[model samples]
Target: MSTGGKVQWINPHMMRAQNFTIRFVKPSRHMPGIVALREIRKYQKSTVTLIQKFPFQRLVKEIAQNLKEEFRFQSSAVDAL
Candidate 1:
């Protein structure tokens, strides 16, 4: 079920279940250029980057405002109940 453009609850009994599987591959350091590619991937993952097009502070403020409105609505709903 959904509320306020978000999923509030899910009925597991009514949903289809599937088996989860995971595969692991062993890395071979003896492979040519594999080590360098792995190092580049590691560096890319470790580095933190921010978008320059939008103001981060404004985004945070908007999120805070949305949360505040949601909280107020929930509080009023509980009071009614």
Candidate 2:
């Protein structure tokens, strides 16, 4: 299953020049961490959006956890996404 995320421009001026969204095409069960991290790295260049679509629930949680752990997020900041 493909997870989905919105990649938004961190710079307001650059928003018009680039695509702001990306579909998570990597398989969740087999290599979720790798895919999530890779996507996060890609999005860090921009800004990663939260996944609210029903189909991506599991993948969202996995990615959220990875973000939380990796960034040492202590509150609902990351998970609240």
How far off is residue 34 in model 2, in Å?
0.6
User: Which pairs, if any, clash in model 1?
Assistant: none
Which ranges of candidate 2 are over 4 A from the true structure? 1-30, 47-81
TM-score of each: 0.24, 0.20
| Model 2 per-residue lDDT tens digits across residues 1-81 | 244543332554454467554333433354558878987788788745555545455566577787685534333554565
Error of 1 at 30 (Å): 22
Clashing pairs in 2: none
lDDT of 1 by residue, 1-81 (tens): 224444344445444354333333333234698879998898788845434323654455477677785423243443333
Q: Residue 6 deviation, candidate 2, in Å?
A: 26
* Model 2 local distance difference test score: 0.55
lDDT of 2 at 18: 79
